[model samples]
Target: MGKNYFEDLFEKAFVYIHYDENVESCIFRASCWLKEANELYSSSQWMSSYILYLRVFKLVYIIPQRFRISKNASYYNDLLQIQKNTIQLTERLTTLQKRIAVMHAFTPIELSHVLQLANHHDPSTIFLNIYAHNSSKEYSFSSGTVFLDASFIQNNSLDAIRTVIKTPHQAHIKTAICYSCDNMLDDANIASKIYLSLLAMGITPRFLDLNSPAKVGKNTISISPVGLTNLGNSCYMNSILQCCFACSPFVSLFIDGQALRSLNQNNPLGTGGKLTTAFTSLSHQVRALQGQGVCSPKDFLANVCSIYSEFDTASQHDAQEFLNFFLDSLHEDLNSSAGKAPLPELTTEQQAAKERLPMSHLANIEWNIYKRRNSSPIADLFFGQLASQIKCLTCQRTSTTFAPFSSLALPIKDTTTSCTLETCISAFSMQEVLQGNNAWHCPKCDVPRDAKKTMSVSRLPSVLIFQLKRFRMIGTTHRKIETSLEFKKRISSGMIVPPSFQSSIYYEPVDYELFAFVNHYGDLENGHYTATVFHNYDWYYCDDAIVQPVTDFKRIYQNFSTAYILFYQKVDAAN
Candidate 1:
């Protein structure tokens, strides 16, 4: 029902990344190779696999030299590196990826860390890299890696009217064609653009500006997060992480998906401790919201607002715990030579909107909660400045508060590899029983002449996140009880329920039937620059309460298209 077409593309990426089918043989052969080499003295050595591994090392040398920011460099270079790193690392694993040999038991914390890394891999990194590239030229991802600036976007990509226009205002934002991704026009961003175009037409009998409480507009801007407004407290972090999880249901490598599959070899449990805490908080609040005796729609609205107020307050409270971390991350950059310029207070209307909320308690809790924020290398990367470090929440080991802190993310970042399934199996499977058969010498796996064991090869499973761009909540304008199902049935039915490792669960479906965003462009932030669109760069995830669909890399552009058209033609992408 949601972006079914992206399945093919996701499979392609998975196959390329995991190098499925023969990974087991490779592990086995490496194990055998080392065993044989050790068994034979210096007088008799079989270094064929080791020699072949050295050949893989050549791949490492070859890539960084060819790393250029040129035409079509991202997908290919990234894919190639992913492949090369897999070969190199797999060859190095002491267990050779054998399930029997690899340890079956792992501590919860240990499991959490590995799952976190496995889920938070390069695809997200690559997607963010491209986003930073499009928003501003000054912000490079490599620099972001070094600097940790989360706010940087390429400012210059939009400065000139560099693109060749096919038509003028005739092409509404909803149905714009992007040459990227082979010009697939049937996308969520395109759908949202159509809806946006309807609004822009002024032909509709009803339309109004969201900025005004009365709803009036000659022009309208979708007030999400962008520009100067930091969603008070750690709402920014919570909201973004929530959006990522909501958008990417196919994501099994994450902590939540531990219910579905074990992505980490060592970890039986999934990701960080965040999901459990967040879910517990959300559940309790939702239950209390339902208990209110409703007299009318006003009562219902009152209830919702109450729940939202409390939820956000709680969220902010949790966020404050990390303020020391966030602040430490930014302080160094704030003091840097480049940062000596007056650091402008980035503000937008949302902050002002917070002032109008009816709940005084929530208002008090909002900004006061995350009053302290430090810098990260990521933040510095965005701002072209250096940030200070914070304490590691996991180890409590104090070094620099930086994310790449020695005690925090150990072993740091590593490369990955990929190759054709057939080629990998064929090249590596060349061994026979040590006693007697004519074999070229199996470099991937070796079996004892008489060992008793059973083996099974199932689909090596993994996932990529894809976002649903046109998806929207249905009842925000009117506080109506939209569902007919009872609460028990809803829970049991897995309706909008986040899936677990063993359970095949789903959450509330995107209210796609009621909304559509057909448009000339789709960008993540839902902005427009007077009708200028950046094609492939349009779909970037914008964080707030509204959930999106499709985090898959292929469909991210659709988000770009929606955001591009809305921002450029209606609002302001530059803002």
Candidate 2:
């Protein structure tokens, strides 16, 4: 019998599976490779080809490295052969495109893996030979395979999920993006680069910001170059499923071995300005990705090696190290600083670049700190007493202590008196989310008439800012407020620093008679400015956050932490 579809492409892969010792292993790898290869043949895009190459390349490189096997020479040799085949196929297709004659370029080297039949350039050879041949159809959650639904994936949440999925135990899922232009049209440059990289990994790469997507609704982001209908049943098609991959030090795939090398060699992070900030932020994000459950550190390294195989191993190592260091920052907010040990003395490196090094400080910040929920009926958890005000009893005994949502590690003042957030809420918000006309109200806490703070804490939120030169994130999530990838061009695109509208980049007072009267009267008319109608009155109110009881301490704790992390990080970083 002839070899299978995948086996034909990788002739020497028999040893990878140890057909002589473990037939099942060999068959499984062969089956996987076969399915992957056929998927490549069925597509005309290079994106899929790149992915397929990485998929096969990983295992091909791994076996030789770990086992010191003789498969090294053969694997590269096989790659050369496949490259040769690909070139020949391209030539054939090109010829067919021009010629008005019948032709056959794909040689029938193996039978259908599913039907035990010969090839005919149809789905039979591709699908049957690989996917169908593998009889195992059922999937368990615990299974190693990451069956990511590609259609409805949220382009915005891609980075978050990438981080979560890489949480040591999870498998890498293929994300899909818009196969449109290279978003290099100016402000779209950065976003375009992100999408292009995602294309190779199957992440959603599109040029649209999908806010408020629903499970079933009419909200479809018209950003797809190929239209949504072509996405079929893939979860990535739904507008509600977009996960943005606009990476900063605080976003995207972290712990990339290759990235570490490049960052150290060429771009030593934390130089100030936008470029340095972006790289440092990117490192943090990639590190967080490593913490996710989707992809493992090993897998990430392997993928890097395969796709960026041309780079020297040392460069790759630097890239990975840098990636890990940046990710380490995201392990928790680089700020917050809950621990109580004094910071170590500055090292030589730290001292040499003391000015260049990042510093932590508490700046202009407003928070809505709340007590732990006294009761949570929804999750079936309960609490007794909830403190109304935050306390730090040890303040009297400890030295002058400060908690300014720091970037570097610092010790808490003292153990006896903790700086814990008490019962009341102290929430802050972004201006972007405040643009809507209707005021968000919550019956339990704040309606339009209730506490303004509560109303401002909850409701519709802005995750990121839409700027050209820089991307800012909402709250402090230690992530970007708005996805830079949403835009196509970079600084050149004018989106970051769009053409200045001389009319109002700052404040715009409402039209009122009070202003007219003020002009008629003297400066401050009499003792105080007379109010005709209180013309410059503030009218906007944010969404209300109804404080519920904390039934589950852990859940509520995590929720609080998530919010606090972002809030303080933003506040401190800004300072």
- Candidate 2's displacement at residue 152, Å, is 40
> What local lDDT score does residue 338 receive in model 1, on the 0 to 100 scale?
26
- Per-candidate local distance difference test: 0.24, 0.23
Model 2 TM-score? Answer: 0.17
Top candidate (TM-score): 1
Work out the TM-score per prediction. 0.17, 0.17
Give the distance in Å from residue 490's predicted Cα in candidate 2 to where it truly belongs: 17
Model 2 alpha-carbon miss at residue 514, Å: 44
Q: On residues 410-450, what C-alpha lDDT tens digit does candidate 1 reach at each position? A: 01111133222122122222222223342222212332132
Task: Please give the lDDT score for candidate 1.
Answer: 0.24
